[model samples]
Target: MAETVFATLTTELVHTRAWPSGHELETVVFSPIKGFCGPRRRHGRLGNVSPDAYEKTRHESLTHS
Candidate 1:
């Protein structure tokens, strides 16, 4: 799954940018990766909800039960 996502990202970046330097590529890549992997980013694996929200819901369910 990780490999697939990264491969897709790499393909998209290469197609969009003509020729990016190492620093420029790093800058462009970091933001999306940070957001995508961050808690606030919604995930399909988590029923299309953010990780924070999913964790909160799970905690609430466990506590309530």
Candidate 2:
């Protein structure tokens, strides 16, 4: 997983004519990491859906019961 993500990021960064400054680069790198580690990240254990989507679906099911 990490290798795949790194490869994709590397490919993207290589194509860019301009890169972010030091501080901005930090933000750019961590933002996606943060999202990938948070509730919004897709989970294979959750049938490949994001945690937010899984929660919303579960909630709706309970509410409609």
Candidate 3:
């Protein structure tokens, strides 16, 4: 799992021009699980999220130019 995340980070770094913020995703992205085992940087930092709320956040980020 750690290797996969590092590989993804490497790939994203290689495409820094396309994703200047390095926050792009290739799938219907879900909010990082918000429980005890959530994402590292976002640990316990977000409120609960549903599919619709996640989509809305994604949409906002994608269009916040």
Candidate 4:
């Protein structure tokens, strides 16, 4: 598992989406200055998600619609 993950992580697969929770979910990594989508520039510039207002908005939108 580690080998596969490392291989995948090292590759150019940075930029994706996901569900609320799961292990077998597809993912993508981003850079600090690439995908800015929040009020504070710092929070929006992460390869990993921090699960804040943006996520809530997305989840609510998906669930309701």
Candidate 5:
């Protein structure tokens, strides 16, 4: 799982030029069985995630810009 996440993030970073060097990239891994709604377990430090309400807005800005 970690390897896959690293590969995906690295690929995105290489392909996308818009993201700045200091930009924060977040990776969230949810259990296949429990999913997001299940018990909240913290394996490591949590990272920043865009608010659900504004997620679509943020995505649109990125794609359109």
Candidate 6:
């Protein structure tokens, strides 16, 4: 999951060059848990939603529950 996220973000950076002109690219790896369960659940739940919809749903879930 971390690999997939890194690869996806890296590809986007390469293609879009979205960062500031003089900024350096840095990668940060965060491991909150030892297994894939959390990532799998998040991916499964959020994967099909469009980004805008996902944000709305996520915000509501976090705020309400």
The lDDT of model 1 is 0.86
Residue 10 CA error for candidate 1 (Å)? Answer: 14
Residue-level lDDT of model 2, residues 1-65, one tens digit each, is: 98998898778864464665667766787888787776787889999888889999999999999
Which structure is stronger by TM-score: 2 or 5? 2
lDDT (Cα, tens digit) per residue for candidate 5, span 1-65: 97997688677654665434443332222243255433343333233442442455678999999
Where does candidate 2 stray beyond 4 Å?
1-32
For each candidate in the order shown, give its overall lDDT on alpha carbons.
Answer: 0.86, 0.80, 0.52, 0.51, 0.49, 0.56
**lDDT tens digits, residues 1-65, model 1?**
98998899888885676765888878787877787778798999999999999999999999999
lDDT of predicted model 5 = 0.49
Where does candidate 4 have its weakest 10-residue lDDT segment?
24-33
Residue 6 lDDT, candidate 1, scale 0-100: 85
For model 4, residues 1-65, the per-residue Cα lDDT tens digits are: 97997687656343244445443333233333244644334344443455465576689999999
Candidate 6 CA-lDDT value: 0.56
TM-score of 3: 0.26
| Worst lDDT 10-window in candidate 2 | 13-22
Cα RMSDs, all models: 6.0, 5.1, 12.4, 13.5, 14.8, 10.6
lDDT (C-alpha) at residue 3 in model 2: 96
Q: Which regions of candidate 5 are displaced past 4 Å?
A: 24-65
Candidate 6 lDDT over residue span 1-65, tens digit each: 97998798668755565544433443222233323333333544577655556787889999998
What TM-score does structure 6 among the candidates reach?
0.29
Candidates 5 and 6: which is better by TM-score?
6
Ordering by TM-score = 1, 2, 6, 5, 3, 4
- Identify the candidate with maximal TM-score: 1
Runs of candidate 1 exceeding 4 Å displacement = 1-32
In TM-score terms, candidate 4 sits at 0.25
Q: State the displacement of the C-alpha of residue 30, model 4, in Å, after optimal TM-score superposition.
A: 18
